[model samples]
Target: MHLTDHDRAMRDGAEGDAIAAAMDLLIRYGEGLGAEVLCDVRNVAGTSTQPTPAKTIIAKEHGWDKAFSVINLDSDADIAIPPMRVPTCQLQQGFNDEVLSISPYRSELVELQDGAESFASEKGINILATCTPYQVGNLPTRGEHVAWMESSAVIYANSVLGARTNCEGTASTGSAGLTGRIPCWGNHREETRRGTHLIESDVRVESFLDWGMLGYFAGDVVGEQRPVLSGQLARPTLTDLKHLGAAMATSGGVEMFHLPGVTPEARTIEEAFGDTVPATTVHYTAADRAHVYETLNDQGSSTDVDFVLLGCPHASVEQMAEIARLLDGRKLHPDTRLWVMAPRALRDVADRNGVTAAIRAAGGQVLTDSCPAMSRTAPEGTRVFATDSAKQAHYLPAILDIEAWFGTTRDCIEAALTGRWKGELR
Candidate 1:
């Protein structure tokens, strides 16, 4: 592969060893993907919280200063970085601790520290720790280019926001931050941006859970192709779209999907497809929605619930308000531990709206910057767990060995209030 003058300079150690090595890896990856020129990446989202030894060593060797000096640090908008770990259910206690202990100096935490110092020495970039960076104003407007690592964020930005980006990995996003360049593939190209799969839903979705189920169903059928959704439903809120994006990403390698009348591209079904949809269109019915729940929960009779978690993309202020309204004078079951995850901004809004007080009064704690599914912090030996997020329920069992129940926010609220899994009708 031919290298640009800038790429050649990096190879010649213009930025020192660490950066040069990182750049070499990125160049190789770009070459592997047949990317001739790197697009300018104004914003970057990553997947891991801690840096690996290789990444840290590279950063340190390059003098973190020169490695990430190209990023715009004055922005208050948060960047969606990668999760430190993938969702897993292997019952290895203290797994993360072991990894961290062995590679203390290398991790997202260390990288974040290094990044903080590097950014501070230059300009301070806002760090909002969550997968839903777009929610906190890091959105790339229509046709604008960006580098995002989080799968859901990539899908949302590309499909919903009409912004352009490829589904990148943690290392690639980091490289983009350092060099401000990304391969212009996938959603970045106009030809690749058009919808390939046609999804027609006959069922009416009333809650965020419904959207999650729809996303899972669409992803299962659509695979990695961009799906253009059509047919009946209310306009989904940002929270609803978040669940949809997360569930879709979890189900498949989908990085972008358009919902007619909701997403920027799909103002109409025809617009989403540019009048050239696939001959076969998948129709989602009530049975399909039920199938989503059944597949996620697994066929189980155990109803003894121990944990109830909410917020996948993290709850928005409106959802928090709804939770507060539902639990205004109620208390969670003493045996059931209910946890709500929200972004720092929404958490503050919840506090101001008295939603935080209501949730706390009802024995639920609203945490900021992280979700239980992402953190792997659910109580050990949790036999029966419930959540409003299909993505959470789908991945949690494989990593935690817990029986998960999928339901709506109301269902979770009821579970918290009663401490029992509300069995879905098969």
Candidate 2:
């Protein structure tokens, strides 16, 4: 890989030892990916403050700075860390203290995360502790290059917002945060962004549930490759698209997709395919949708739901309002617990607007920063769970060894109220 004079200077320790290590990692990462050049990036989403066993052990052996140097920067050198060079934010991690009484997660982990947060904040990393950074205030401009870590967020950035990013990991995003540079490969290049598979929907994908089912089907059919959707679609809001992307990322390793007329990069089907023709054309019919629905619910056997989770990629304000409306006058069943995961910023919006109060009145808690899947904890003895998020339904069963039922938000709310899973595909 070729480095500019500035890159060379950074690698030669002109900026500092920490930055030099960061530059060295970027160079090696770029070259390892067969990338010839590195492009400048201003926006980055990472998980440097998340408390893990590895991070804890390293921090115990060698202070937080060395922990960051080894875990984040991929360097063993002892050097002082500096403020982020570019704008960066932390992603979803362990549960916060507010839900300790309800969740089975440990309190010590939360304390460790609090200390990690302090260290990260002092290093100029914004604690936008949600999977969806675009939801808060970190919306990247169209066609902007960014290094984001979350799979759902990566899909959203690449497809919905037209920003360029691969499904980045901890170390690469750490390097990007300090250097403001990432490899100009994968989704960053225009040629590689073209659609690989074409999916035509025969069933009208209008509702949030329908969109999520379509995304799950698309991901399974296309697998790590990009898909272009053509027919039988409705105008999707941010929340609907958010669910779609998150579901796709969960079922498969889909980082980017194109809705042709809807997404920014493609104005037509031809543009979505670029100069090359699509490799395959897949038809998504009503039967396929039903199959996806069944697949998402295959883990469940009991009709009695012990828990209901509303968000996987974090709930948007619109979703919060809808959830609030559904549970306005209803209280949860005595045996069931309901929690709506959201970004802290949007949780504040719900709090001020009485949305949170409405849900609370219904005995549902709207928590932020983490979910059951990330925290690896659900309500104690949660044998069977129900959720509106296809992503959560697809993941939590395998992660927690619990059963899940996937359905509409209304169906989930009904389960939360009645403690029974009466959800069937409508």
Candidate 3:
């Protein structure tokens, strides 16, 4: 790998042990990936990554700082870790102890999460612990470079916000936070960001669910390549875009996509493809939507919804407001449980606007700083599950051994109210 004098100095230990360690790791990464240079990352969003312990640490014998380094940084170096050079925030943790009653080791897990938050904060990491860090304050501009860990956030930053980043791992992002550098490969290059496939949707995509199906279909077809969407998409809301990007990242390894006239890169179809015409064109109709719906929901039509989850990408303020509106005068069935998850900042905003109250009045929970993917715990006797997020529906069934069903947000609310799955894409 070719390194500038500064990088070489860092690798040679001129910048002390911590920076030297980081630079060494980066050089190894660059060599392993055939990258010739390292690029500076100005925005980072990966402080909440919890390393699985090899064995249980039964007692607090070591200090929290030391334990944090061992668990998060994967290093036990004596040097104190430096602050992030750029804007940085945490993604979601495992679960919130104040609300969740599922984890058997609830007390210990919460302690570990709290320790992680405090340690990262002391090292200048903004511990928001929400997947949607942009909702709080870490909004990166178009074309700006960043190092992000959350897959959904990576896709959103790359495809929707036009920021450049690849889906980074927890350890690599920690190195980026320390050294502010990453390998200039993959989506970091401008050439790889262009559309390689064209996707057309004949269905009118107005809601979040419709956009989600389009994204899932397009991403599966194109795989890791850039997909140029030539569909008639209305002016979608932020929630709609979130659903699309989240499901796209879920179903496929898509880092970025271009939607002509909607996303930043594709002002026109020609702009998306540059000189080359799209190598392949895919079409999505009502039949495609039905297929996606069937693939997502493989459950029987019965009155047996044990759990109904919302907000896989973490609900925005507008989504929360809409959910509140839907549940204003309604009551959930006694057998059903609704879990609404989002960033703490947005939850506070919803609380101020009486949205949280409306949800709680209807027996729904507004949880923060939790990712269902990380937690295998569910409500006791949970057999049938329903969710509005395509990402959640894609994973929960296989992970939790429950019958997961996908539907519209309205359909999920109706399921919560009546304890039934009455949604139809047909």
Candidate 4:
């Protein structure tokens, strides 16, 4: 593979041991993938909490600390909580406690505290462990190249924002920051951006959760390819889009999708495909939506729900406010444990807006910098769990061996109130 002067210098160990090791690993990764050259990454977003100490230590050594320190575009801190970490763990064989002790996971109860501090002191690359980097300030302009690690962010940036990026992993993304280049693959090319699968939805999705389900449906059908979406129901908000992107990322390896009139590139069906869509278009009707529900909610009937989780992609202040409004004066059932996860800044805003207070009064705990899937902070002995996010409900159970259920936010609130999954809500 060809290398620039800087790349050669780094490879030759002129930059010092840590950077040199990182570059060598990057070169090997690039070579393995047949990446010819590297591209500069304008922003990076990754999973907030890591499970093992080895992963966290490696992330920190590369650039996780530096990425979270700066504000991305949209003026909000570009931080997001993704569903990547184990929910809970016990002492097990082959687990390395000594490695885990390298970084105190909760030594300081603040977002990006250890990573940010380490970045400042050690002078590593910038890396914010948020899923929604575009919202927080790492907004990459249209056509601007970036190397983002988060799956949803990759799709959102490339499809919605018209920025270019590959669905790169955390380590490669960190290396891109140091080398200032990424291999021109995936969404970086124009021809690769066209939709291979066509999706037409007739379901009337009114809630963020519904959009998430739609995304899951699209992804499950389309698999790892881009899909062009036509037809719709209600207008989607940013929060809804976030859920859609995340669900798509989880359901499949979809790095980009075109929603007619919604995504920047796809104003119309013709525009989305440029006349290259497959002859057959898959129609997702209300029945199809029901199919999605049935497929995702595979767990058998379980009246008792031990845990309830809200806020995948970290709820925005506005979303929290809406939750608070729906939950005012309503108490969560004593048998149910409720948790709300969001970005630290948004959590603070929700507190000031009394959304946090309302949720707490309704028997919910508001946590920042992590989600149930990312932090693995669910109630002990939680055999049955429910979430408003379809992506969470679909993936968490398989990972944690718990029975997971998907429902509307209203339905979730009703379950929390009743401590059971039944009645009109079910």
Worst 10 residues of 3 by lDDT: 50-59
Candidate 1, position 137, lDDT? 66
Model 2 C-alpha lDDT per residue in residues 1-426, reported as the tens digit of each score: 988999999999999999999999998999999999999999999998888898888887888888899889998888899999999999998888998899778998998899889989999899999998889988998899999999999999999899999998899999899999999999999999999999999999999999999999999988999999878999998988998898888788999999977779898999888897889999999899999999999999999999999987899988999999998788999999999999999999989999999999999999999988888988999999999888889889989999999999999999999999999999
Per-residue lDDT of candidate 4, residues 1-426 (tens digit): 788888789778676544454467677777887877765555544332344454344344544532322211111123331211111111001111221232233442333344443442343333333456565556778888777766777788888899988887655554454445566666887788888888877867767767888899888888889888777657889898888888988888899998888877788878888858474689988788878788778873797887888887777788788788888788889889787767655677788888899998998877655555654446666788888787788778866778878888777777788888752222
Question: Residue 50, candidate 1: how far off, in angstroms?
Answer: 3.0
> Residue 311 deviation, candidate 2, in Å?
1.2
Q: TM-score, each model?
A: 0.82, 0.98, 0.94, 0.82
Q: Candidate 1 — which residues are off by over 4 angstroms?
A: 1-3, 51-125, 275-279, 423-426
> For model 2, what is the alpha-carbon lDDT of residue 151?
93
Top of the candidates by TM-score = 2
Overall lDDT per candidate, in order of appearance: 0.69, 0.92, 0.80, 0.67
- Choose 1 or 2, whichever is better by TM-score: 2
Worst 10 residues of 1 by lDDT: 86-95
Q: Could you tell which candidate, 1 or 3, scores higher by TM-score? A: 3
TM-score of 3: 0.94
Clashes of each: 16, 0, 0, 22
Stretches of candidate 4 above 4 Å error?
47-51, 55-129, 423-426
Residue 86 in model 2: shift from native, Å? Answer: 0.5
> Could you give me the TM-score of model 4 versus the true structure?
0.82
In lDDT terms, how accurate is model 3? 0.80
